[model samples]
Target: MVRRHWINLNGMWDYLITDSRILPWQFYKSEYFPFDGQILVPFSPEAPLSQVKRQLLPDETLWYSRTIQLPENCLNTESQRLLLHFGAVDQICSVYINRKFVTYHKGGYLPFTTDITDFITEDLTVSILISVHDFSDTSYHARGKQQLKRGGMFYTAQSGIWQTVWMEIVPNKYIRDVRVTPDWDNSLVRMRIRVSSASSAENASPAHISPTAADQTDSQGTVLAFSPDRQNSSNVICKVYPPVFLEADGLNDTLCQDEITTAAIRPGKGATLSIPENMQKSWTPKEPWLYPYSLEYGKDRILGYFALRKCDVQIADDNYPRFFLNNQPYFQSGVLDQGYWPDGLYTAPSDEALIYDIRAMKDLGFNMLRKHGKIETDRWYFHCDRMGMLVWQDMPNGGSSYHHWFVTYLATLLNWMRIPVKDLHARLLSRTDEFGRQEYIDDIRDMVRTLYNHPSIVTWVPFNEGWGQFSTKKVTDFIHRLDPSRLVDSASGWFDQGCGDINSLHYYFLGLPVPESDRVLALSEFGGYSLRLPEHSACKNIYGYKKFTTSEALTDSFSRLMENTIVPSVKKGYSATVFTQLSDIEEETNGLITYDRKKIKMNPLIVQKWNTKLKKSLHS
Candidate 1:
């Protein structure tokens, strides 16, 4: 969710890393605490861009302090409220304003906000402090692909804030959340808008989408009520605009567009907006169409956008269960996107850097990206949505150290032997922590809630390569309950439970095979051909499934792999193929591009030609 009016709180900030035994609040209240050198905000301490190239150990606590003077317009008034937002903070964090605790949040990937109107002083000067503690891989927290001892596929572990921190002003009574569900089969869109008031209880019951007009409640369960005598007795009005086919440069004004249809509905209730056949524009990777809309409740208004498109698996004319986009058989040529940077680690250097990655992949003819083992920021998803790139999002994996001999070596052997291994061995998979398992479930809910509005995401991948895998069928069922709209890859790579919509397989050391299954077939991971350029590499050590010495050799191998194996498999019921990776990370040289993003290891024309062949093979 993005706001038009907000202040970014990113820059130099006073920071200190201390022993976990030191009480930050006690020292803050006493007005005396040792301060360390300044570290760049938002970038973790371990990141090179943060200027302080140091890692926050598990036993250490990272503290960030800064002073902010609020604008007069943002100061709390009778009708306005001030809210502070953190895009994300690793593991756990606590916030203090004016030496008093305001809020605490857990989970590292999703955004959290707190109302700080009451904490504002008369002079509009606020002293803010944040303390963060990240257990990294030592605990059962949801740390994705981050390792204390980094090497091979795993990268350096980073802690503290790794995303934007900002503030915004909103009405006392505001739209808390909005969910847009596109009913493509019915040619309509369903919207669920939740509104909250200052007078309501702090903790209210969760709002469920119902056809009938019911009381409106915020995401946190606060009921939204208005007096009978209040003006505009109609609770809420929703206006949906016609779909716009905009050029890449025209996306900046999407939120300020005009509407074509209006519907009045009670808050928290579902309202369907039918799209006329003449105005219906299906969103695709070639032409991503977006329909903007605004929700107005009294003086509060918020804008959002959605696309009228559907993703499903259906038996095509070839009598194979193939991936379908907008009811037509489609072959997804995708790349495994790690979303990591050599400079920023978990974060990108700039917004343009994020866009560059998506655009670069698109230019290389990759229509989809399997965001592997990590959840990205909203801006990354926003770029994917607007750029028309389909996404398969993976839930970050977390648990104690896995038994590599069993989960990795043995699983690989089993996969090669075409023998299925049950995910019931929780201890072997390092999922024995009952509390950690529940936290993973909660993380799923939060991730879906935050990213549900994006139109580019087509699949949800719960488990990858048996990392922290447990209760595969049950987790797939839970994801279905959470969001039945998108397809789910219950278990990717190995340990298939014979569930989920896609029969996902990964091949690196073995030959690519056309799998026989009732579900859609996908080579979720394959073709890890690597060419490491020492000048652009993150480390001198090389790790890849297949090694190559030059760009020409890698490109030649890629062309043969696509033409001989992947393109031919499309006709044999392979609905999707995701290459090993888009870019190199740390010591892993199995990427099409180098770690610094300074070079594309393969010839673009050769890659594009093969990709074109993949697209045409679906119909041929």
Candidate 2:
């Protein structure tokens, strides 16, 4: 039996609005800002659910205050590490507990936790204060598809706590962080653990997710046997006490990793298990098998999992390049999943909603999904890994304004002209503001570290369509060095920097792009065929390459476009195709699913059949 409990800290909470500082006791004792509004947790106020439904202006501060109660047994342990987690707080955030300033975190799309066990006492009436400032298109911060003025493709701004907020108590000595690196050539998952401080008396229990299913034609492999709590890792946790750093300088990455000699008593400094040939069942859309495990460091224990799969750029017999999985040619059929919801802006409405998208896409024969621009919560990646889906995760782009003509128009024309853009892109994006350049580097690293473990992620796209593009060659190589495990799409669209794993392309307002002879060509983005169902559309203002009123016509046009353009391009070396989107966002109506998630646009079986043939043709 599994232990599970999550008190939904969602729903309505008494909201008190104030600009200046007033004693908490003073406000509650009398009537204040009578203009009340209901704001949904895990969803920013800019979203529909947040009754205020307004943007977080660049120059203005949006303050939010809410009180929460701890789970029944959470505060019972006096010696435990009581941690509070925030999925995300855009731009910046300052946290408070029971009127006491506890910690502050500064990344828009990363998870952060603080130990409030000591300050927290009695019946858990905790006051959380978060302040956010988002400069969607005004400043150089990572703002994916969030437009303050809102038009075309960009929608709305998501600020302050758009993901779950909960409390968990860990034993003094516990597993702080787990990094699993899978070595396919060696047939093992190299495990690394970050433990709490040495003085912490808590125990550490380590474990791994073991797959039960055996590959009939190949030999089955096992992970290294985990050992009990021992000591710590060589890495150190930078922030020892309250008020964590506003922005962690990459300066702290390795140097701050505390030196811990005592960890698990396992014999393997690294472990290797044998994977029998042919008996191995490589992860795929049809059958997704996952192995979940747990680990302990001191008294702290962490749960995690992984999948068996491999991807790389290999030259095919016909002399063009392609992505190979397990040494076999596999066409990456994907959908452009813009991580958004009618209720939750950057956040998914629920975990089930995230899983629904992944499973639904898999059922439709899509083996891959390009996590477009926006970064999704960990739960989303976990689902993709467990379900055996391929992923091309994009690094959210943020920099000075795009060169409108070069990025939107001229670059698209360059795609038609068959011109390379490494030199051109470098020159264009180099002129961006200093803050923009710094933030891009900061967010990309955070993005990679956050999703490093999930087996489903196979590609890292640094920039998209020339937005915030810079040092194309160097950035591509840098990511390759940071994580050599996956492919790197240096530039994903019209900005064709001659770097990265494959020659990524995006075609809209036109037919399928022609594959080049030198590299593996991928229709990374295209087919933004739209269907406007007034009942389910996110907003009345619509946008797409083309729009259809009926599903039959949409499906027919999609199938015909693929049969003539995309299918033929694959044979000619175009390795993958990620359709416009997964769901109809505010203005984008080109998703196979609707914004309301009420219906599926195309027949799953039909789409599956087409995808099956597409894969087979590539290998054939």
Candidate 3:
């Protein structure tokens, strides 16, 4: 659980890249003596924003060291525990506090935490050392779109702390996790709050939430205490702070107490909250309303928000499956957003930089963005939630090598021929390692858990173009069970399992795609009209499906594509359509915007007019 009180450990830190493999205590010793230099936190060493702008190879290990002084109030008592949270650390990592080993973790994209209460001393100022080893494409880890050799489509590999690092103080027994699921059909939100016990002994007795746990004011709330007299265990008590509603004004600074109601939180259990009739607001792209809530356990309070919305695929009046938002037909006109930057490869330069990308797309009249093959910082999703943008999240691809003949040309040919190829062979899909397949499952589950709260995320693409396609039915069921609320495109572009919600397709040179299945039809990817502005380009050798020298030519082609292809497809039961991209990356000059984001390659007026036409046609 995230708390209101925490330190943002995202500034400069002492960094060192070493060829030697040393133990955690060796950093404090004479070996690997002085730190090489300083690097910015949250940005990978390979990124320009980081001072240490160099990649750490597979053989070398990256080290980060910093001295942090705790505030006077953090874990002031013996009954409190200080938790250190890492938003993400690439590959494998180990942490040490004051030269003592704290914890170790694996995987690159998921967040992890360890309790540092026992590691702290009387001085309060503690030394932190993190050792990171990322094998990049060499190992079976989930490195989203990161390649050792940077080029078109693939990007530069990065390691070490590539995301936010922070620490929060909480009571020994506090709220560990809270999951809120919005039920639009019932007009109620189901909330499940999990509490952790402070008991240290394994044989200690268990406890349960009292029957009188809900609707009890602070005065009437029963304060549960941990097992006292245990060696290191102190009497940790908790107070149930009633949940309150706040206006969805971005940060939820305004309170909406007129329609406010409270529910009882059972210890080690879940609770349900019914939306007040006066405050029931369905979240839509037209009117996105977020219900901000703060659930507190003892002194630790964490802010959370939820939206009442749902996306489903159902048969329309035309006898074809159509996408519905809040039980009403909604067309998903989206752009492909490869969340990359000129300064930061995977990471955005700043929080505002992330906001700008989403805002830019929304301003252009597109309602959704397919985050291609990479997950983003939590704040990015928050902006989408507050600013009214939908997202179709893609799981990062990993495996040996994709079958060019089968996945590319042959698959495309078969798609044109309307022949469904059962792409289960490991070699065909590039999935050779059994361990890697398991890791992919684990990582995808973690990704779902991490981003489940955002209402903007309505769809999950497990395998795109059969890059690492394996066990399609199993994986698709797994993702569906993870968040039954969201739609899952099991096999997005090719190798359709015919299991998921949509029959997704990708067409590049072909004139827009038409519905070929009884299920919801989606042109998942199309229209790669490229305009390379040399001044704004990142690389010299530009690549795209179609190239245009002039902005006028590009805009005209895009306008024609939308008018003749996309708009007509909508009338032919095309429920959703995602254009090739929002911005260019590396050598792929196919974005509507330039790679550096300095200029929009197409005319805004033309693009907006095209989008307006598409929306009007779909709505009509």
> Which pairs clash (backbone N, Cα, C closer than 3 Å) in model 3?
214-264
TM-scores of the candidates in the order shown: 0.94, 0.83, 0.90
lDDT of 2 by residue, 1-620 (tens): 00133344566644434443333545544656342566777678778766767666776666666777675666555567677777777867777776677887766878887887777657765666555556567777777777777666887766766877776667665555655676665555555445555432221222333333431112334333332232245222111111111111111222233222122423222323334443344565555554444444444444445556678878887677888886767789989998888887787777788888887888788889999877888778767766678899988777766677778788787777777666444447643566667667777777787788888899998888888777778788878877888999878886666777888888886545574557678888888888988988868888987888899998888788778777777777888988888998888888899998888987776678788878787867
Q: How accurate is candidate 2 locally (lDDT)?
A: 0.68
Q: What root-mean-square deviation over C-alphas does model 2 reach?
A: 9.2
Tell me, what's the RMSD of every candidate? 3.8, 9.2, 5.4
Off by over 4 Å in 1: 30-32, 198-234, 245-252, 255-258
**lDDT (0-100) at residue 605 of candidate 2?**
69
Cα error of candidate 1 at position 104, Å? 1.6
**10 residues in a row with least lDDT, candidate 3:** 231-240
lDDT of each: 0.84, 0.68, 0.78
lDDT of 3 by residue, 1-620 (tens): 44666788999999888886575455476556578889999899998998778988988889899888876655575778888899888879999898888899988877898988888778677778899998987776777778888777677888888889998878776776666678898776766556667333311212234434333222223332222222132221222222223222344353444326554444443344567676778888877787767665565566677889889998777777889999988888899998888888788987778888887888788999999877887878888887789999999888875568888888887777677888568887888899999989998999998899888999999998888889998999999888888999888887998888888999885444464686888989988888888899988987888889999999888888887778888888888889889899888899978877889888888878878887777667
TM-score for candidate 1, residues paired by index: 0.94
The predicted structure with the larger TM-score, 2 or 3, is: 3
